[model samples]
Structures are given as structure tokens and as C-alpha cells.
Target chain A: MYRSKPWRIFQLSGFGSPEEEGERIRFLLEHGETGFIMEHDRNTGDHLYNVDHPEVMARREDVGLTGATIQSVRDYETVLKGIPIESTYGHPGGGVVQHGPYALACYWTVARRRGIDLGKLPGTGQSDFFLTYLGCVTKQQVPTQTGLRFNADIIEFCAEHMPHWVPVSIAGYNGADTGLNAYQELGAVFANAVEYLDEIQRRGNISIVDAAKGVGGVSFRVGMDLFEDVAKLRAGRKMWAELLAKRYNINDDKAQRLRIHSLTAGSMMMYPQPLNNLVRGTIMALAGVLGGTQSLGVSGYDEALSIPSEHAHQMSLRIQQILQNETNLCAVADPMGGSYFIETLTAQVEEKAWEFFDEIEAHGGFLNTLDSGWLHQVAHKNQFEEQASIDDGSKIIVGLNAFADDVTPFDIDGFKSSSSEWKHALERLNRVKSERSAKLAAEKMRDLEAACRTDTNIMPAMMEAMDAEVTMGEIGDVFRNVFGDWQTPISV
Target chain B: MSALGKKILLAKTGLDGHWRGVSLVEKRLQEAGFLVVMIGMATPDEIVSAAVEQDVDLVGLNVGGHIEVVHKTVDQLNERMVGVPVFAGGAIAPWAKKELEDRHIEVYPPGSSLEDIVDAAFRLCRINVKASTLKIEAQINPKYSADGAKP
Candidate 1:
């Protein structure tokens, strides 16, 4: 009697102001979405800085374009103000690696303030290495080793307290979009997982079972590789089970179970005839479901134009909803599990992923490659070659390269003219700086700086900073002093 | 040669560091006898500052992020570089292609050939060209990028 839960209808809903963010989240949940993801502004969240910082102040308007400007746990309180945190499966934004601890700690602090037990809270934190290192390379971030320590600390913290929480999820979506094909995405994710598991093992504090649970939930991108991407997801589950059982010798099936979240490839949404992207979105969502993903987010039909328009966001949710309600996709597990082409691709994706895993290991594992920019180069090489193919007439993208004539009169100018939210974010950022307790915040930051210098777990100190209402820019300053900027191995 | 009179500045406006677009374009431009000054991800201010400091002949921007950022760079450059023309490319969609062209700034979206881009580079710098059969076809009708394809 397996009543399969319909794939968690999730979307990365946010941007600009806290109220606007709340409105959007409520909109998604009201419409049909079962889960919510708070996306913090990249300028602030990714850099762990507030808008008052010089780099941010230089381009103040760019702040909310990426996400809402959440300066404190108080802001998280505003965003999740009336929402039932206990019932909702939430993803509180910490998309960048360095920002992970602060993002999660802030969310946890808010939940704790409500007297909600940390042990019972259900949500996930994303301090994705691939997103940090590959996708949206931040202007400033901690070194790979430091990022690893931060992630490891989160894993340990969650395992002990927030049992239902997924501490850190590595997003293969970033790597795939950067140029890793199907198998490479899987191999790199597992390789990155070992970095955390191995670090925790060396510490000898937590059970491997607990560590596996914290790291087991991972995300990958599904693209037009259709069968291949679907196969990638199925392969992801079996590979995760195998890796944990074989490498860590974990005996619990609960620990070995791999929970997958798939974000339809943002790069796949072509800019021309943007409506064609709706079909692309539908196909990608179908692939995600076929791959047995526990959760899915469809890239907007207008993804190439700008951040998803309100209509585009609704269409993405509608596409997923249609698949869930009309297609009867939820009745089976690994729906395409045993088909010949799927099986072969699954095996190939799994096998090639292992080869890629070995390649990363040869470069001294995932974090080492990122630190040295080895993986970045591999992604770049593929990116160049693909473009070369389009240039040479070897490849053809419909709206871009062929049959581009469209009859529709509708325009997708994207979110080009929105500036009011950016202005509000700056104002709110300033207000937090003035209203927060000054002395206690400084003390907590000093402790955070000390923790960063030493190899001690930084999450607890980070949570203290949030509790004392320490701002994003203050934490960013501490990181600048401690880790300095990654020279960024990536160059075109 | 350090004093090679032909230098083109290459930069990306967004934080996205996918270098393939710039690298391929760089390779094509370099092959056509130009030195590409790769100023990887710079602000519009930085781009202008580099244009003056480097004394480059032409500017090529790989517009990966919000095209508005690229437009800002172009608008700022319009006043700064009177004779020095600018050409751009990347995940630039068709909608932006028209706006960029309206400003007399040459726009090359995903499907543009290396030949076309190189030719545009020559045109921007006022260089001589053969204007052969293939070049004519490319200028008249460019090929499209394959679905879900990236460079």
C-alpha cells in the first residue's frame, strides 16, 4: 500500500522586498505549491554582506533583482511571518556555500523564537558547492576548505538537533548548466558528498548514519537530454545507496535512501519564441517525474528573458500541477526504471559518473578541483565547444538557429523596469543597522571571526550572531578579514 | 607584439563565470589577427576605465547576465568612445538583439558563427575584408543554435 506523495511542488519564490516575497510565497502556496524556498538577494546572501557594504552600495539596484534583501533573522520572521513553519517544507535561502551557516541559523533562530522545537522543524538548507563555485560565482566567498568546514558543521548540527532538516544539499544543476553532461553531474555530486562525510569522520563526533541523512538529499538539473536526464535521476538514487553502503559502511536503509530535487535547466530556456519554453518546461518536468525526483522546480518559460515574470512563474507551477493531476505520474516509483533505453542510459550515466568521480578524485576530490579551478576549466571547455558547434552549423536551437518566425504579438520584455523594490531593500537594510543591538552584535562577530581563524565549527557562533541581530555586511567583513577573496580560477 | 596596434577588450557584465562564450569568441578574434584584452567580469565603469587605460581599438562584451547591465555599459561607452565601436554576444535573446541594434551596437546572439563575429570585429575596427560567398550567406542568414545547446 504505497500512496506515493505527489512530487513536492516547489519553486524558488522571492525577490526585492520582504512583503513582496511574502506575497509571492503565499501566491504559490495558495495556487498549488506545497513547499516554499526563500531566495535571498545574491549581492548580500552570496557574499554574506548587507547592502550598506561598498561593493553592494556601488550597485544598489542589483540587490533585489536576485532575491529579497533579508538582513537579519528578523527579516526571516517577516518573510515567514504567518506561514506555518512547522507544517511547510521550507528552503530558507543560503544558495551560496559561504552563506550557508548564517542562512540556516537565521531560519532556525526564527523557528526557535516561536518556541517551535528545532528537532521537529522540517526544512532544508542549500549551501551548494556547485552553485557557489560553478554557477553564480560570487565576488567574494570563503576558500573551498573553509566552505567545506562550514558545510560539515551544518551537517553535524542538523543531525543532532533538527532531525527532519536537510542541512546541506549540493546542487548538480549548477555544474550541469556550466557544462557537465548527465553522468558528470552525478559523479561530481557524490564526489562532493565524500568531502563532507570524510571531514565528519575525521572529527569522530557524529555517527556516519546521521551524516548520511544530512547529506543524502541532493539536487540535479534535468534538461533536453530527456531520457538521459531522467536516467540520471534514477541512477542518482541507486548510486547514493551504493556509495553510502560501500564507502561509509552505513547499515541503515533510512540513511542510504537518496532524496532528489530537480530544477529544470535554466540554460535550456531559449530566448527567442520564449513561449516555446513552456513546452520545454513541460518536457523537463515530465523527465523529472520519470526520474523519481522527490521534488521539482520547472524553469520559467521566460527564463532567458529575465527572472520569471509572474505569469511565467504561474505557468511553471501549472505545468507541474498538470503532470501531477492529469498525467497520473505519482502512482509509481522510478516510473521509467526498467525500459531498455532508460536502463542503458541509466547504466551509462551511472558508469560515466563514476569515471567522472574518479577524475575528481584524481584531482584530489571535488573541493580540491574547485579550489584549483580544474573543474571550472572542464566546464568551460565544454561550454566553448558547444558554442562552436552552433557557430559551425553542427547544432541547431529552434527559436535561435532555425524556424524563428513567430506569429504571436505578446512581448516578454522580462523584469527590466522594476526598481521600487530595490529602493525599499536599501532602506530596510539601513533601518536594521540602526535598530539592532550594537554591543552584543559586535561581540558575536568577534567570536565568529575567532571561530573562522580556528578550525572550530562556526554555525553555533553564526546562530549567536543572528540571535543578537548581527547584520549581513558585518559577517561579510569578518570573512573578508579571515578568508580573503578566492582568486577565482575561472577566466574566459 | 606589445605595440600591436589592434587590441579588443573582452569582459562579462554578470558574475556568471562560464568562460566558454568569451573564450571561443576570444579564439576567433585572435585568429583573425587581433589581441583580445580579456578583462573577465567588470563593471561598466571598469570597462570604460579599461578602454581608456588600455587604449584599445574596439570593445566586445559577453553579456551573460541581465542585459540591462550590458546596456548600461554600452550607454556609458557611447559618450566615452566616440569612434571606438562596440559589439556584444552571449545568452542574449532575440528581444534584446533589436534594442542593441537600434543603438548601432552590433548584437550577436547564440547562433552567430565565429566568422560573423570575426567579420563584425573587422568591421568595427574598419579593417579590409574579402566579402566572399560564405561571408555573404552568413551575413544574409545566420544559423540557429540547437535546442538546449550552450557554448
Candidate 2:
């Protein structure tokens, strides 16, 4: 079954200046990567701030460490300069919910400027709550209700205009990596899907089937628990199909089919004897392929230290290539489907997941759980247990807890972020601020803010704001003032 | 007051908020009877002010970004409060760890155990590590380490 449909070899690639990010992306594409993911700087992109924002300025040296510093449409242009956006399955990074609109608008604006039709563009905007609210909680973000509204609006906007785009892909990967168990990840993901579907149904403008199709392209984290994770993917697909058919009572084949993207779990990568992570990544990637993922991203071996170095990134791509070309693992879809052990595990996971789903519903659904710190509690409990096992020697991670010594000749001192990134990004921010039509930008920003204040969908105004050259920090200002910030339930 | 009940101030220097690492450490410290005042993702000024205001026994910095930011925060804290001991843990690289260690700050990068961190806290708080270990042993079983004997 898998032989017919090849998995897309996607890699999360970006760092330093926009030009450098472009060069790196170009290198990945040239080296057999089927698609590319643009990783924006977590300090800026995740927080929706510009380089000059006080919070960013306070830590200016970290500007381009996590990812590239893309503050405007012009920066997006610089990042996507040589890449063929029309063909490549680009993931213009907006993993955070509040930053989703800005990231998508900037990418779409760049495509439009290149005379590419928005309808034909194929890409994904993450806008994941797990990333924004739970896994990597930003210093500030719009409250859950506002985040729900923004995501619903994005789904609606995508349904009307950008039919090809996967808007708001709910990533269970972030939640799992943060500490959610397998069944909890499944339960929380479906709980999130139900929230989105229920809201769409209430709106009545977009059909539930279309909304389901848009949200069905979810991602999961495949980790060292090879069999269980593989079973999770299978169970997830079956659960998604049953969910649509049972809850919504609608079952178009396209709507029922769950498109999965799997990333190797970064948290599982060990800091010591970093080369061991290559084996870990390969095994995790194999799990994803065997589980019949539509796309896969193998985590870099140096993941524990920092973002992928060039060699680490290349090694990740090569692992996927070897599996795709040499192993013949993709020759059969759901190869372990009929195995007695696999089938039993899959059924067990599905049952446990539904029980978890009921627990979420009993506690007032996904957003409520996040708001009340219920979800964080669950993740934290599991994290503690896992850590305890490792601490007590019940769980032995080679080269870390068990085989604790290594004398390798490989000089692996993880990638360091460029010091000049802040200086350059600040210059670019100033240039954009000075070069743009100040009056038009101000007017458009006001329009965006007004849209945020009202019940109107915020996408069109956001697009206009991007076109008007409004910087990311300005958009964040509007969000902070209009929507207020989320009271983070857990004390991080 | 209990030997392990020394107050500690913990803060993250960067905006990236993957809290699993720090949260785990905080939980371990708290379980070991440390009064952890967690200030999540604070600026250098906020960290220094909190360190002074809280009047904690030790300061724990969770470093998640460039070493410069963490270094600056540590330098400011040292300048303002001369004798306060500081230890850090997170995704700190080898070079960065060396730099931090050079400045007399205890560096615990990823994979450092909770036991080690707790031991460091005991040491920084001026509590006898040997006494703390004996106390833990006594708590686990009174017959063990009652006379402060090594297990």
C-alpha cells in the first residue's frame, strides 16, 4: 500500500540571516530533500516580535539561534529568493498560534508578488496550540478564546481562497515531545480537532467536511518507543476516520483520510555521545515509514545541543534517503497491520485514547484543559515518571545513563548561532520601517487591529497589513492591546 | 529550618519556553526541600532584582539561548549581589559551558542528573553534602546512615 504513495522527505531547515537561510534551504533541496520547512527564530517568530522589540533587544545575541530572523514580507522574500515556492511543499514557519497570521500572510504576499496564484500554492501553516500554549509557551500570547477565533478564521479563509493550503495543522508532536504519552497525544489531538470542527459547524459558513479536510493533515512525534508509536499512527488514522463518521455523520473519503507528518522526537536525542542519536533518528524514521506517514522529518543527531549543524542536517536527509531507496521498507503500506501483537497494541491504544478523549470532554474539552493546567499536569506527571525511570536505572539510555563514557574522535561541539545576526536583523528592520509607506502601513495596521477587536475574520486585514509592510512587532502590539495575553496556567 | 529548606531563585534567560528541562529540575529541587522561586523567562534586570528581593540562598539560571545573554545576566547578578552563588542548566553547549564555568558559575548541561543538581544546590546553600546525603539516607530508613556512615 505504501509503495504507491511515496512519503515526502521534509526537513526543518533555517538559521542565521534570510540569505543564509535561503542558501541552506537550497542546499537541502539540491541534496534530495523533497520539501523544506522554514524555521523562523523562536524569539521573534514564535513571539511575533521584531528585532527591536524590548524582549528581543534584551537578548539580542539570540536573534538567529533557533531559526532565521524574518521580521517582514521583505525578509520572507529574502528567505525564499532562490527557492521555487510554486512547486516545493514549503512550510513557512508559524508554529505558534498568534504568529500564524503574520507568517502565512507574509508567505502568501511573497507568492502573489511573484505573480503566483494563491489558489495553487501548496504549503502548511502550523498555528499549533501545542506549540503556542503548551509545549513552547511564549512570554505572551493571545488568550485561548482569541487563539480559537484566529484559527477558525484561518480555516474559513483557507476554505474560501487557498484551497490547496493545509491551514492550521495541529501538531501533536510538540505535545508529545513536551511529555505527553502516546494515548494522551492521540486524545488531546482529537479533542483539539473536535473543538475546531464544532466551532466551524457553529459558524455555518464553511461545511464541516471542508474544515475536517483542512485540519486532518496533523503531525505526530515518533520516538524510541518504536512499536507503540507505529501503532499510534495506525490507531490515529482509524480514530480520525471513525471520529468524522460518528460525530459529524459525514464521510467523504477525502475528509476521512488522515494525512500524517511525523518528526523524530528531539527530546529523545542524547547530549553525550551525540552520534548515537543517528541510530535513534533512523529507528524513529523507520517507525514513521512503517506506520505509513505521508511525510517525515528526522531529527538531527545534534538536536540535544542546538539546532542542526550543516553536517547534522545533511545526515538527517541521508538517513531518510537510505530508507527510501535502499531498505525497501516503504514497499508495503501498514506492513505490520495483521501482526497479532501490532493489532492488539493498536486496538489498546485506540481504546485508551477514546477514554482520554472522554476525560477531556468531562473536563470541559481541550481549551479548558489547557486553560486550567490540566493538560500540563498530565504531561508533567509523565515527564517526571520517565525521568525517574532514567534516574533509577529502570530506563537505560546508552551513552547517557548506562554506557556513560566515550572517547570518540568526532569533534561534535554543536552549532553556534552567528553573533552578527542581531546587528544585521536590526538594520533590516530599520530599513523596512524607513522604506515603507508609513501612512499606509499605519492605516493598514489600524485596520488589522479593528478586525481583531471585532468578530470579523482577521485574515484579509492581516494580508493587507503584510502588503503595507507592517513589521511583526507592530502586529504583536495590536494583538497584545486588543486581545490581551494568555495567563499561562503552569509556572514554567 | 531544615538543611534542605534554603530558598533558591530560578529564572530562564531566554524567551524560548520549553519548560520540561527546568520544570523537572525545579520539581526535583522542591522535592529535596528547596524553596524554589521560579521566575519564568525574565529579563536580566528582572532576574537581578528578583535575586536581591527574594534574598534566596542560591540562584539557578535556565539558559536556552546565546551564552552572551546568560553571561550578561550572571555578570549583573554578581556585580549587584557579590557573594550569591549561581548554577545553570539547559541546552548549553561545550564552549558556552566552559565560559560559564570560567566565571565561577556551576554549569549543568543537558543529561546532568537531578541528583547532581540537588547536590550542587546543597553545596551552594552552604549545607554539608555529606550531612545532606546522610539525612536522605536516614529519611529512607532510620537504621541506615544514623551515625553519618557512608552507605
Candidate 3:
């Protein structure tokens, strides 16, 4: 157990404007957050669209509600203005697989402009297939094979240049929160990791050990199932170590060490009696801490109602502060390691997870299940059963189902984005377009499109494209023309 | 007891595509016998056009972003498809909920019961049902009650 290492207090923060998102990040840092994550506006970031895209234009008011409207490297500069990228750990807002290269490139480009060395910058990028294809299915995205290429490219690029960066964190949090049960989440996550490792091996640019180190820093979701979730995390580490050692045959201890980041499940945060979620967040965070997570992000109390308000965000930070400072949680790793029940449960979870992994492999691996909707069906069935259990009173959610009456005067209305966010974002987009060299941008865009069509690693061209001020939509257009949209198996 | 051919058009107002809430609602609505047309993540103009073209009795908006977008869609529907009611459910903030309620659009935030949503659909669509005909026969008769009591 890595008891000597301190768990990073990572929190997801963004919304309204780049300036506002920067302010919020600064606020969280001031309130004892060890790491910060920049969340991009879903309308633009997740879909790789700009503010002027027809789909975004129709919902202009939604431009900055979910996150900051960052369309180019210029917006990344504003969002990261005073943050110490070299010393501080950061996640630069690329949870969606298709947008990972663009987001990482923009963040790296801004750092390069500021004279920061890529090798010294410590951070992670989320190019999660679970998020891209299964969790939040976009209407248009590059196919899974293209996504795999992008991720493999990122892994190789990071191994060569950005030594301190965790490239493409496979987030099982998205899958679990979507509906996969504990063991299913574990199995699917490892299966997803195998996809990355197998791709890296086929590419043969980076060593398998180094690639495992890059892909080992995965994320999981911790819900109200306290002991079970703790066991899941424990099982996750053991399984990762076993998979690398047994399957790959060459395991450096550092490469085999599975670094976990646990986020409190947002779906577990109930809407009514929002304040009650504070306790829920605490308990879930405790599970993460007890399970020996390397990093953690607690869902806000108002998660079910709206995006986190500033106060709600502060409360999340406060909960972690109390857990870290007062509870003596950091003094030991794997505190429940010796408990008979915990040990049994951890072994049981690992066994079930391997079974699920075998099932996914039988169905032609994880990516195949995603393409054929087999994984989606598994998640959908779990969701239906969970909903039925809650409806029938078998699962007693305290504030929601059991104790439904609330008389507290908390007055929590949740955060609402400013109305001027769209107008401001539009102005910034126009300014960037007008100030940059149009011919140079067009040439770089063409080069990027050409790179996408070949076996070439797209990162270098992507970095060049970012420096040339190519917007997200342009890169997206290149991908759409070359790779085309994925055929989503499930109907929304 | 039959929905009497009542139809409801459903669409997400924003591009955000977490479909769990919307999918569950669609399943419940279909189980209740209303013909559901799910055109996911549609634009305001497209939603209005579909409602009018489909001649739906009600519109269901699965909102996951700023309420202003949903308000715009509702305005378009009211202007083009007159006499059609709209209801919405998602992670709506209280202020947005109030804004939608003021427009006479029922807003169901998270934790809203599916039964209540199904009931609201029936009422809003003006489906008149006598008490005798309201009962839905069980698809499978169980030998034991849910609590293990013999039936």
C-alpha cells in the first residue's frame, strides 16, 4: 500500500465564462484543493463544436452553463491564466474521446507559449470511450477505431514528450454512474484498458510497460454502497496488478501500481433536501479515502438539481478538508485490508469482475460490445432494475424515498449561468478568428486533415493547428470528413 | 383505457446526451399506452415542426441545459402548434422551474416519480378514463405478494 503518498484533493470546476471558471478554480485552490480540473462547455467541448455551430446556436443560452466555452487555445489561456501548471496537477477538460487531442493540444500549446516544459507539467487527460460512446452518446463523433487511434497516439506522444502526464484516463466512473454495477464497472474498465494496451503493442512505438504506466491511472465512482465501493476499489488495484503481471509477462512495480481516482457518484445526490447530500458526499469520499485512492472528487450537494453553485462547491471542499485533517485518514493506506468481511468482499468482487471481463472478451472485446450495444444493454437492464427497486421501496433512499418530508430552510436553488455568457463567448470567438492569420490557420487545418487520413500521429499536427488558432469546430470538421460519425447502437 | 390514439412528441432541448432520464420516461409513457415519438436532441425549429407534422397532443422536453433554450422551444411550439401542452423533466434549478411553471409548462426535476409523470401526461393530453376502466391487468399473475404473502 502506498501510504506515504498523499491523495490529491481534485475537484471539477468550470462554468459561465473563462474568467469566471478561472476565478472558481482559484477559489477551490485557495480552499485547500491540491489539484484542479477545467470543465469545458459540453455544447462545444464534448461535441467539438464552436459557439456558432448550428447545433450550438439553437441552444445559445446553454453555451456556458455546463462549463466554460473554450473554443481555442486563446480560451485555454484565459482559463489557465495564473494557475501554476508546472507545480500543480491539472486535468484540462477532455473527457470526451473525440475532443481529447484538441483539448490536450490547446492546454499544451498555452503552456508552451508560457515557457513551460511539457515534461515537467503533471496532469491527466480523459479520453474515455465509456464517456464518448456509452455514457454520453454524441450525435456525431469519430468511430471507435478512430478514437482508439487517437488515444494510442496520445499515449505514445505523452511517453515521448510529456513524461509527467497521465494520458487517457479510462473513467469507469462514467460507466458505473450510467448503470453498470460494481463488478461490471470493474470488468469493463479493465477491458477498456486492454484495448489501449493492445493498440499500443500493435503500434510498437512505446514499450508496453511505459504504456501501462500511462494507462494505469484510472477513475471509478463511489456511491452510497460504502463497503462495496471500498471493496471495488481495493479489488480494482489487485486486478490491475494481476492483469499486467499475468497477461503481459513483464511488470515493473511502478507500471503495475494502479493509481485510482474516485469521484462521488453524482446520481446518488438527491434533489429534494439537497443539504442531505453533504453527508452522502462525506460518506462516499470516506469510501474513496479508505479504499486508498490517489485522488478524489466529491460530487456537489446540488448535483441532482443543477450544476454546483459556489457555496455547494465550497462545501465539498470543506468535507474533504475535515476528512483529511481530522479523521487521520491519510496516516494509513488500505486501512480495511485486514478486516475479514472486507477481504472476502474484495476477493469476491475481483472474481466476479474477471468473469465479466471474460464475458466481454467472449463478445469480441470491450469496443465490440460498445459497437453492438451489448454493453449498453447490460447497463440499461441494471438501470431499469434499480429504478424498479427504488419505485417499489426495496431500495430506501433516505431523503428521497423513506423520509420524503423536508421542512428545512436551506434555500438551495443551485447555480444558474449568466445570460451574457453566450454573447461574451461569441465576441471572443470572433476576436480570435479576426486576429489570427487566416491563411496559416487554413494550411494547418488541411495538414491536420491529411494527418488524420494517414497512420501518422495526429498530436504534432494537432499542436500546430492549435498554435495556428484553428478552432475546435475546424478540427471536428476534419474528423467528420475523414473518420465520419459513429453509428450509435442505442436510441436515445 | 386505451390512450385513444393520443400521441406525445419528445425531444431533448440541448445537445447534452445523457439519455437515462429520457429513456426511462419514454419506457414508462409507452407502457401507459400513449404513442411516443422520440426525436432526441432536436433543435427548437425541428421540435416545433415535428409536433405540428406529427400532430402530437402534447410535447415532452427532456431538458439538460439552460432553461432559456427550452423556453425558446416552448415559445416556438405555442406559436406554431397552438393548443398543444408541453411538460419537462431533468436537472432543472428552482429558478428555471419557476420560469417554466409560469409559462404553464409543468416542470419535473430529479426525484420526480414516474407514476406522477405518466399521470400528468394523461391529464395534459385530456384522456378521460372512468374508474372502472382505469385498472391495468397484470401481465403475469404472481402466486405470492411482493412481501412474500401468498396471493
Candidate 4:
């Protein structure tokens, strides 16, 4: 199985203007990265606000720091310039629920314009509930029920239209980084997958087997506890297979195997001794490999300080390359198999994971937990306890709670994206507002609003809106009017 | 003086919502007998107005964006409430930390222990640590005797 293919080197990268984000993608692709991820500015993209919106205007300086500002199809075109979308494996950033349809529609629209078949496109878009509702809860989001509908629509849309596209990826990495322990992460990830699968099953638009295949491509986070993480991944695959077989009665081999994309824990990166994180990255990457991940993204060494600089991004790629080339670790499948310690640990993790999964089920599934803040409370408790461990010296995070001393050496100031990104994005937003056929944009927005109010899938109208060059904020207005805002359970 | 009346205001200074640090800091301060009020995500003007209205002894910012924004908030606080101390913690780079320190703002970047954060809070709010510890013990075990006697 390991020899079937080498794990893809996928890095989360984007910042500044469209041209700048495109340049960074090209750089990563040139530096042995197998795939590129497009990260849109969270301030606008997560909230679906245009740069001209009042909220964005208040904190204008933070506009381009997180990712690029892609307000419309025009911005998407500029970012995808000369990138050969048909041949590349990309993650067009829609890590939030409400932005998923727009992000995917823009990319698919760009591909259709380029004469690429929709069925042949290879990419993934994450409308992760973990990221949206639990980990990095945005300022405004559609209710959990609405978010569920959006995800279900994407699953069915991909099942029919784009066979190669991963409609939505449920990333446990975000949840784990937030505070979920290993077992809780595993349990929550499966509980989340069950929500999608059950929703797709309820709709009866697509076969449950196909929907399971779509949800099988998930990601997890690996931290400093190398052995536990390796065991967690192993148990995760087993649980996925067992859950599908026992719950959904899917005996298909293709549907049974889970494809994992592992990212090293970003929270583990130290702020004081940033260089020490390189070793941490290497070790976490090794755990992913041992756990048999299908793809991997190493968190930059300077993750705690800021987004990855070009050197740090390059260093991330090098760590993956060194493992793939120099280590010869890919020669054997299940390298940790048959070891008594690993076997026992994997079983124990799986057992504990099932208990947590059952606990969530008893409390009313995953979405209800998020809506009721039960999951957040659990994570909150763990967060406090984790800090307690560090405070009591039970946990020694070398440079953080233990070492307590560091020499003044090299300084890593972190990456600074273009300061004028917000201004440029605002200018583009205005140009689209004026340049686009207003009549058609309004009609498309009405259709999207109508779709949001009905049981019909919103992607078709959303795609039409993107074609009409509808602004992100306009779409957000429709959502706000139709679905209103999600009452966040926990106050930030 | 007792720590009961000390009020601490915590607010996130950016649009980004990563509340792991903020939540922990709030809980720690509460355990140490400080009343903590969280104004989820606030602008400089909002933070300043809230600080004034709440009459907080100290203002803690969970910085997740540009240092310029934090500076703006500090400037507003300094202008509005002359002596209310302010501190911050988040994804602060060394340079940003230095910049904040230059303005006499204590920064607790990532890797900072909770003990240090609580210590900073007591120091910033000018509450005696010994008094706060005694108050916490009294609250936790109400019937306990002070001179090593069992309840």
C-alpha cells in the first residue's frame, strides 16, 4: 500500500494580492510541492464580506494577512493565471461553510472557461464544521442546520457533476489544534462524517456508498506525542471502515479505505525558540508517514509567530522531500505493524475513540453538540487541563514551560504580505460592482436567495451568480436575510 | 486590599476568532479572584469605550492581527483611561513584542505559561498575590482554618 504512491506534498499557502498568491503557488509547485492550496482572506472569505463592508473596513489592515482577497471571479482568474488548473491538484480555499459554494463555483467556472471538463477536475474544497463552528468560529455564519444543508448539497453536486473533486473535507486538524485530545479528535471526526453521510443518505439524491467515498478523504493533526498520534491514525482508519460497514452496510473495498491528509499541529510551534519547531515538524511528519497518510502538510517552523515566510515554506517542503527521498521509509507498508506496543496502543485508542463517539451520539450527534456548545465545553476543559499540566511541570514544552532560557540568535520576523492588499481588493470590488451587468447579477442573487429559502441545492444558482460576477458581500447579504446569523454558543 | 473588586476586561483586537488563549486567561484570572469580562471581538473604539464604562482595573487584548491595530487600541486606551494598565498575548512575533514593550505594554506571546499570565494580571492590576491566594482558599474551602487546622 505504501508503494502504491508517495504521499503528496501539499502546503497551505496564500497571502497578499492575487498575483502575489499566484506567485507563491508557483514557487511551491517549483519547489517539489505536489499540490497547492489557495487560502482566501478569512476576514472577507470566512464572513463572505466584501472588502468594502463595514466590518472589513474597521480592521482593514488585517485584510490580506491571512490569505489573498478573492472577492469575485475576476480575482480568482488573476490568482489562477498561468497555473494550469486542469493539471494541478488544488485546494481553492473555502474552509468555511457559507463560502464553500462560491469558492468551488469560482474555481469550476475558471476551469470551464479554460475548456476543462468538470468531471476531470482534481481538487478539494473544505466547508469544515470543525473550522467554522468549533475551532475558528467566524464572526457571522449560517445556523448549523443551514451549514448542514450546504454540505449535503455539495456532496450530492460532486457525486453527479465532478467525479474527481472532493466536495468537502472534514478536517480534524482544526479541532485538535483548538483543544480536542487524540481520542476526542478521532471520535469527533467520525461523528462529523456520520452527519454528512446520514444527510446524504436522507436526501436520496445519490447513493450512500458514493457519499461515503467523498467523506473518506479526511485530515488529522499530529502533535509532539509521536507514538500516540501514529496510533491514532491507525485506529482512525479502522474505525472508519468499521463504522461504514456496521452503520451503512457498505462492504465495498474502495469505500472502506480512508485517505488521510496529515498536518503537524500548528499550536505546537514555539514562539520563543522558533528554530526548535523544525525538529518538531520533522518528528510530526515522521509520525504521519508511519501512520500511512495519503498526503501531508508540515506546519511552518514559524507557525506560532506568523504565517510562513518563503524560507520557512521552503523548509517545510524540504522536510517532506528529505523523508521521501533520503529516509527510504516508503519501502514498506504498515512498518509499525505486528509490534506489540503499537498494536496494543492502537486498540486502546480505538476503544477510547468509540466511547467518545458514543458519548457524542448520546448527546445528540455532532451538529447539535456544536449548537449547544457541548463540544466547545469539552475542548475548553481540555484546554484548561493542558495548561494546568504545563503549569505544574507535568508537561515540558522545551522552550516554553521547561527550558526557560534562550540565547539571542537569529531573528525571524515572520512574513509580511503586501500592505496595500486591502486597497487593491477594494478597488477591484468597486470595478466589479460597476463593470458587471447589474441586471444579471441581481437576477442571479434573487435566484440564490430563492434557492437558500427552499430545499433545492444552491450550487446551480451560486454558479450562475459567479458567472454574473456577483460580489461576495452581495451573496452574504442574501444569506443574512434568508438564514440570519448563527448564534454562537461560546462567547469568544 | 482584597482582590474581589478587581475587574479585568479581555477583548480580541482582530476579526480573526481564535479563543483558546483568551478562554484560558479568563478562567485563570477568575480563579485568582479577579472579575473577568469578555468583550468577544472589539475595535479600538469599542474597547476604549468598554474599558471606560466597565471601569476595569486592567485591559487584556488577545492580539491576532497587525501590531498597528494593537497600537491603535493602546493609543485609544491611553488617551481615554489614563492609568488603566493593558497587556496582550497571541501570535506576536519578537519584533511585535518589542514594539509593544516599547510602549510599556506587557506581551505574553505563545509559549507563555498561565502562571506568568496570572502573575502579570495581579501585577498590572496592583492586587497583592498573597491576598488573592488566601481569598481563593477561603472560597474553595469555606470552613478551613488559617493556621494549618483541618476543616
Best by DockQ: 4
List TM-score per model, in order. Answer: 0.91, 0.96, 0.96, 0.96
lDDT minimum window of 10 residues, candidate 4 chain A: A410-419
In order, the TM-score of chain B in each prediction is 0.80, 0.83, 0.84, 0.84
Tell me the interface RMSD of model 1, in angstroms: 9.1
Candidate 3 backbone collisions, by pair: none
lDDT of 4 by residue, B37-98 (tens): 88888888888999999899999999888888888888888888998899999998777888
lDDT score, candidate 2, position A352: 98
Model 4 chain B: weakest 10-residue lDDT segment is: B135-144
Task: Say which docking band candidate 2 falls in.
Answer: acceptable
> Looking at every candidate separately, what fraction of the true A–B Cα contacts under 8 Å does it contain?
0.17, 0.58, 0.56, 0.56
lDDT of 4 by residue, A287-396 (tens): 99999998999999989988899999999999999999998899998799898999999999999999999989987899988887778777877887787777778988
Query: Taking the tens digit of each residue's C-alpha lDDT, what string does model 2 give over B31-150?
Result: 777788899998899999999998888999998889888888878988899899999989887778888899899998887877788889888888876323533211221112322222
Better of 1 and 3 by DockQ: 3
List clashing residue pairs in candidate 2. Answer: A1-A333, A2-A333
Candidate 1 vs candidate 2, lDDT winner: 2
lDDT by residue for model 1 over A405-472, one digit each (tens)? 89879777765525455567667767776887788888999999999889787888998998999887
- A197-306 in candidate 2: lDDT tens per residue? 99989988899999998889999999999999999999999999999999999789999999999999999999999999999999999999989999999999999888
Ordering by lDDT:
2, 3, 4, 1
For all candidates, state DockQ relative to the true structure. 0.21, 0.33, 0.34, 0.35
